[model samples]
Target chain A: MTVIEDALFDLAEHLDHPGGEELEATVLRRINEPAPFDASPRSRVRTWLAVAAVVVVIAGALVAIAPARRAIADWLGIGAVEVRRVDRPLPNGPSTHTVPGSLGPTSPAVDEGLQIATAQRRVRFTIAVPRDPTAGTRSGVEVDSRTPGGLVVLRYPRFTLVEIASQGDVPVVGKLVAPGEHVDPATVGGAPGFWVAGAHQVTYLDRSGRVRTDTVRRSGPVLVWVAGGVTYRIEGLDRVTAARIAASVH
Target chain B: MHTMDRRSDAELVSGARQGDLDAFAVLVGRYRVSALRVAYGIAGSEAEDAVQDAFVKAFRKLEGFRTDAAFRPWLFTIVANESRNRRRSSSRRTKLDLQVRDQPQSAGAAVDDLVAQRDQRRRLLDVVASLPDRYREVVALRYFAGLSESETAAALSCPSGTAKSRLSRALNMLRAQLGEEVTL
Candidate 1:
């Protein structure tokens, strides 16, 4: 890179931009302030439907019913929920995964040497460590540097992993479900969670917002939950086991 | 909380089109920095106003945005246009202010090195600010806002080739202006 180019990049990376909260408040105030014209009836209907669907999901009222899927798909559009079920078990070895679109690529490299205590200090959010470390099970952690909020992965022996993030709004990487898979709503430690069974395709949206299929697929049963401002995913464990481990998090 | 953070841009745009202020707020929060950078690059003194105007316009015209397309470039296009409009209406060119608040010095850096780096950055910013409109906008979108060539094109409302050529020309201008002080 040329010196000027390097300087440009340095400025880009380091330049202090406006804080999000202030801008959000300003924009929200402006948008919410009364406007001269009212919204069209069609827009009102769509808004009602979208709000209703989100409320249902957050309230844990939407079961994995076929009809609800269509509503969610329509409401979410490109961010729709997809479920697929596969007949075979997921592979045992390490697999690479990618997040579609602007979220950037996923890394499978585990930080084998990082201790739970050290990771807790490095990350911005609270780190939930599994209280009951299964005997003879090796564990590791990896942090994806590219993501703005930072993605932390806790890997256990046999491909079981837990992905955690504090940004509750961003969707988890991968398809909502793989082929022949099922997503069942559940509660972990009194927080909302999902039980994902079987392997599923992961889809990403590139910079252009076009969906790109990830080459890597995740198999086996996985449990996902959000609590105390953190979202956690525990994979390769049964519902009971996952629940137990989740409850034991410190 | 779930409604605000988890939904994709398309979903947020849909909600915003439907007059969901919360959804719109999320979008604002997500792109505010990039929008500000793009606006500042073109409009300088009126950057803040340009951003506000662009976002307000974007909210009002949410229905026109295609849900399948990328939101950043689309939003940026609006910001860029707002900057241009502001620039034309005012007919005044304000120098870009490159001064950043002093951050705590890094562990090993000496005070002298930091001062020299700051001076160098200021000089580079001056050169960049002096470039012609076409060149300045391209440099801002590509380098300042960190958009790819295609994205910069989208923001500029130009063809990809046009954006690329403009950027190349901008870099050459910067190199020429800076002379041997900075390498391009």
Candidate 2:
């Protein structure tokens, strides 16, 4: 190998990445073993046996079930934003303060004000801006770093574009759409996307994994899509207009 | 039965296919770090979850494994796919800030040389990060994860020639960015 090629490999050795100490145990536990919870001996043995049997059964059933799980996760989840068809939407009101310093009912207004460049620097993923003049005239841009992959809110005259990063398996934003709500599969920028119209519950998963219900805005429709490792949600626009604005994002 | 820890991957895979969880656990213990590294290369901070999911998925799909094929590459392909899928579904909140570990100073090594080496390493990392995803992935799988060219191709779900060309392109791009002097 050339010196540069060798250097590349040598550099990789020193680059700090996560250690795999817990990984083997975690993977094994998920696949086979039951959780070693503290319990009375008699019950523990029963529980162990029961859970072991269940694990065996589940292990065998996983062949049939794993694909179904992937399909469901794929269908309802658009990267960071997941849309669940719930039996009933949360009471149509602004979200109450459930946790200390949790996001209250108000949506985009909660972010600390910052310049667009500063916000861009603070985030790992690229911040896409709509090129369309109608949606491009940004009123403000704010950064909320409370989530793993920070959240950026770009306010326009007619719509709000909220970008959240999906850095892990955890769902960053969860939307509960009721039976009557309009939830349709969409294609934006040649990538799969979703369009949700009408009232819905928008919950934000905080850094600590707490669910913070964002206020339900009955104002207009919302366009959600995952492109280039970021979930983009545009609210307050019709489907065609939202698609156009989403396409203009670069 | 043969001792589980020292058994070849093929042996463990065969045992695991026959419903031996211990054999699979041994395999998990062996490949967890490599899988995590490959996953992190693609999925960033989400590598842990992606790796865990990949292993579970691999376990479920072990029935389809070809007896003669290498296991690590097959497993890595799943890791790469799991990471990519999760990455596609997720967006970033935190930047992937990779740091170099502090190395013990060599006996009588010049301070200036050490500083220069550190600077070069940092520049190399920056350039690698800036490369397009395709090129970046090849560098990651081949050099970072230490996969062989064929292994990299298998993990990428591409032909060996494609992997070879991509790695060459990636190296050329790296050399172009870092300049030829660094190579010497």
Candidate 3:
């Protein structure tokens, strides 16, 4: 046999030249190889048990932190909630007389670290959400409440969210909405909710080790709230981080 | 553009980074079949496996994807690498060079039979599959990927001279394998 000079241009044609369309579904299924999130009922129970592990850590962190830093900012206004005067001023800097700030609304958005310095104190935190996309494996429901259309349907038989709020300052990675505030008219977290509207969905593991998603939109001053077990956040993450996520949201 | 339309690729990357499977899926859908076909050409029957590896790897490493570069090329690069790996691991060599030399010279073939003669396509696929790994890589980078000579060289991490010679020799080998069926 001899060589041929011309190569196949049937790429578009060949792709359209379906050898087997079922292979697409097969590849997708085989690709995921959906290993059990919990190999056994025992293991599933163990995963739920691990959620308890973070409780101690959450309690400890909250114990050392303050409730809110109310120095004030130009665009943001403080609510009627009481504020403590600590030496550690607000994050980034001391807020003047506008909005009160915490480490940030608890969202996965905190992955990028932040540093705020003023005469009083300096607040610092790091975002530690695991960003592996292929796994798509979470114990319960994987959701996208950031947008009304951002919801991801879960086929699992059971899905649940449990919120365990700490008493005071637990620089948690989640949205920071007042106890009863709503961005639009959504009932979130049993408390009124202010959802983060933006391109990126920030994720964080709460004190319970449950996953939380946050986004930041600058349409209005960003509001922060925790609903379901996940945190609803906007402008709660770093400007660069928030901007990055907001840009991707469809 | 509306606010939704105005989002940047960086944002999309970030969203994908946060386990937003839909965002990542959108990214995957864009490269889906193009990636599959390239993998298919290089991977042959194992195209499905190679495409899966590429998609999974691409999705996992998406944080490293820069918004500025064309996502398609980067995706193909991964698919190509996975296909190569699959070829190596399977160790399934079939020595399927063109068999036109074995053909009987009965020139009385029907029209449908003449047109349906995939001796050429089969030979191209066979020679490419049988070439040395390095040369085969160049051939695929050229035809399967449709890269220019320089692009082919760059993709193969070789000098253009090496890439050109590899492709030339690969074509020559296929022609030798096909004998009379060699088009050029």
Candidate 4:
């Protein structure tokens, strides 16, 4: 681990933002004042990002969409995504129903709620698929992909995907879960805790480069599984983009 | 457990959204340091300006906040963006006064060395200033400021994956830029 990581964990154990209430009062006053979108902070950055994205997109769409490529052309690793579409359609896959399992984590008040472990793993993965840009589909893919990658505990999650062969020359990995069809166990937590076996846990291989045995549990999307911790989510982007994102995980 | 009494972020935001200055104060109290750090990292020249601008913008647009969302990320989004803008417009550099290395009243400890370390951080900030805006933002957030992947994503208004990817690339760039002066 780098000094930053070590120091961060150490700091997490001792997170105390010490200061003055006068500052908070000042902040409160500022937030309540009226402002326009163009005059807002988000608009300014969006304007810059939009300009940059437009400029970069024409010359390097492949790289522009590739999240990690921008960071790691000579970054930590050689992140390459080959999301090629296969002419031969993929075979039929299993199906499942998903709803907004937004009940956060199981109650800490309940003694039998999700039991959490304290071990940490260096998480890494590559998401290599793109869903429609609709809010629902995009949200689902992004949340699910990134969920298990960060610090959180996982419960039983099921995924049934029909292989999506790319029309263009790109290598797609992992079966793409269908629209409105989500993996079973939803994510949980905001703290730095790892899921023992989370719902719809996105499995990652270890140092040995072998797909680890995935553990899926039996409860539905009950906060009962999350153990009241912070769960990070990863949504799926285009296949090429997914690969880039995955490769960037240190 | 504190969960029962601890109100949800949505609840807090709702109260703040209604012009409950106290509730908004709570939200601000909850996030000021992180917000300040984001501003300080990006707009050290006018870090305070970036911070004030972000808080003002957030309050002004309180009604637009989606009720179900968490406040930290939303607040961070405003702060992060403002930091970027401040950086572009403000040329003033942050003069970070190093915390005093309160050493034990012993003779063997190299207290001078600790002071040197402080200077190293100050120099490190200079090195950081030399980096591109994107890389600088990521380094400040991820390492110095200490934001999580999701938090950073919320602040940047980008996806978590995008945040991580950018952070990784940025860190690598920093490592390359500072060479041996700064270690990851």
Candidate 5:
């Protein structure tokens, strides 16, 4: 019992718990401050003003979508991925269902999706496999070749990895993130990336800007990065595991 | 520099109850790291704010604190509550990342052995992180915050027996997953 207890403490020491900074000053400062009035008219006015400012900003972004979209795509572009901040609520309709890898009635790409060997042979770039120990053997693979270079989806037991080759001045993959959803900067194999947490919409676009309805789905937390001109989207894993796998991709 | 005060927590608590801000400040300095650890386990990124809030709340409610009771556990209860509240309101579970130690392996250690140990530690961390919130909370309060079983129970608002059983169950699960690799 003592051994296990001591071992637990040793392990706890390695766990990177945050809040290492000196907090005494902040606590004392807050204590010295007067208590806030919860329902004061002044507080309510401040709240409304903040909400009004957010509304104006969101409205401005929406109205500027045409020119803003391209600039955003270029600014946030990592290899073939285009990251866009969308202000509207995610569609609640059955068309944008949460069931991942399932194609809609109108989309026929699922039928066209190929096996791993086939996907590897069909794509121009190398189809790298995740080398993380827990990644295990890929259960299956799906290839979508609507663009110049194909998009490959590798399905693992615990998560999914999607890869797409870089397209110059055009994005083969698009991520539309809503307000409050996080798209934190990350690094994959020494290359810049983005980690999107919470529910967000992912869209696959062709050279002509046509949405690949079959690949469209609302995704969960995903780590997106580009290494060797291949944009990789690892989904359904925590950021740390995703990063480990991302670093191990070969 | 101001002279260091060697007063016990009881003395500080007593002084704090009598509106001695300096006494409370010392108490804060002593327990801030442990309080933050508990808060971080629950609230993640919002832990800094949560810890500060917990300390303030503990200060305001100092009058109710019994001098006979252990100060750490009592303060931990408030910290846990404040952290849980923050987590509940945010509705986002921030993943905790375990860092590698800065020190190198011993001179006799082989590269393969170092790699194996690192991998084992990563797997252990993953298993710990994946544990259910209830089990994780008990483990965090006990191991991470260095709280005793009774103190963990006090912080969690549960019986000491419950805390003990939960720790046992959590350890068993870790052992089951880790197998012979877990020396403990």
Candidate 6:
């Protein structure tokens, strides 16, 4: 190896391996379990029939009404905001569902439930908190200081939570709002933000770019916005409430 | 256990393709550290999940893997692709840092030498981290993962010539960044 190659390997030796038996067990468990989409032969046939019935009905509706086609086409637009209105009520059950790409190991735990000031001191970047009293109490704050651009999550417990970090600190991939979730554009304290309403599947890529399946399936609405070179995700509130809470962040 | 360890990756991969979980588990055990390293180099904080996803995906698609092919490059390709997808989707780029805590300490004259070595390593890491995504990745695969040129090319899904050129370019960029700090 050349001098540069030798140096590269030497540097690589300093990286933390962090291996554990638990990781292996998790992989084994996941592979052994039946796939989420798998079902019995009879159930498969019934599902296909149900799907066919729905398709026929939708086709008849499209054929009967020309405006429906236009609406469908408009819904499939590739712009920032694409709207699709559902005629029927959304399924009712557990508000949270674990989508295929939803699970992954939790972010490295910082000292949880720290006071805002203490949490801020622990991280490199400034931590922004919602200034609104009605935004609820600051129940907890956690900081992951492992990276140069640290990650701070502020929790208001049941009311709402805000995750704040520098632009490049966290590698966020996949749709912020999963398929079948409703998303609309709104302003957070006059800055542009996305108001995602209803329970949605959130998929995040692990550092290696693999879909993470370890995150708890979040229920309820959220507001995602960026301000002052920081990305903020406010969760557990209605669209208007979430936006209002986001606006109050300082 | 020793026999399992002795089995080539291809043999294990063949067994894995036939629904042999033991074979797959052995493979995972063998490469998990290497996978984690490559993942960290590519995806940073998302390394754990990325490695898990890559392994699962590899298992699900094992039937498609050619028997004659080397397993490491093929697996690394999945990992690299996943990392790239993550980089694109998140629009967040992270540079890996060498931590002092992971290094061993020394005494007396060796202590000074160790300190200098650590500093050099840190500087080199910083320079590599500053490199553009493409160059950084080639370096990570070629140097960090210790893949041969042709294997790196296969992992990258590029021609051997292209891989060689990229490696040369990446090395030159690293040298430029390092300047007179270290001789290439």
Question: How high is the lDDT of residue A93 in model 4?
Answer: 27
CA lDDT of each candidate?
0.61, 0.64, 0.40, 0.41, 0.64, 0.60
TM-score, cand. 2:
0.48
Report the C-alpha displacement of residue A160, candidate 5, in angstroms.
59
For model 6, how does the per-residue alpha-carbon lDDT over B45-65 read when each residue is reduced to its tens digit? 667777777787777667678
Tell me the tens digit of each residue's lDDT in model 2 across B74-177: 99888888887877777773334455666778999998888788877877887877777678778878888799999999989899999999999989998888
lDDT of 4 by residue, B1-184 (tens): 1123366677777876654666666666666666666566666646667777677667656767887787777777778888788777655544322122233445775878756554555455555567777866776676555777787777777788998898888667656666776532
Residue-wise C-alpha lDDT for candidate 1, range A85-195, written one tens digit per residue: 334333334555443111124434223357767666666777666767561254666665433345566766643444444343323243434234566777876777667
- What are the candidates' individual DockQ scores? 0.20, 0.27, 0.12, 0.11, 0.22, 0.25
| Alpha carbon lDDT at A203, candidate 4 | 17
Worst 10 residues of 5 chain A by lDDT: A51-60
TM-score of each: 0.48, 0.48, 0.42, 0.42, 0.47, 0.51
Top DockQ hit: 2
lDDT accuracy of residue B2 in candidate 6: 26
Tens digit of per-residue lDDT, candidate 6, span A1-250 = 7888877776666765444556666677666542312111223233222211111111110111212212222323311322333354323344243332222233333456678788778666578878888876777676655333555767675454544443332233223233455567666666555666666444332222233323325446666766665556776777667767777788
Report the TM-score of candidate 3, chain A only. 0.20
Give, for candidate 5 chain B, the lowest lDDT window spanning 10 residues: B94-103
lDDT of 4 at A148: 25
Which parts of model 6 have CA positions greater than 4 angstroms off?
Answer: A17-21, A38-250, B1-4, B91-101, B106-109
Local lDDT at A166 for model 1: 38
Model 3 misplaced regions, further than 4 Å: A1-5, A10-250, B1-27, B91-110, B113-116, B159-161
Task: Report each candidate's C-alpha RMSD, comma-separated, in the order given.
Answer: 16.9, 15.8, 18.5, 23.9, 21.8, 13.4
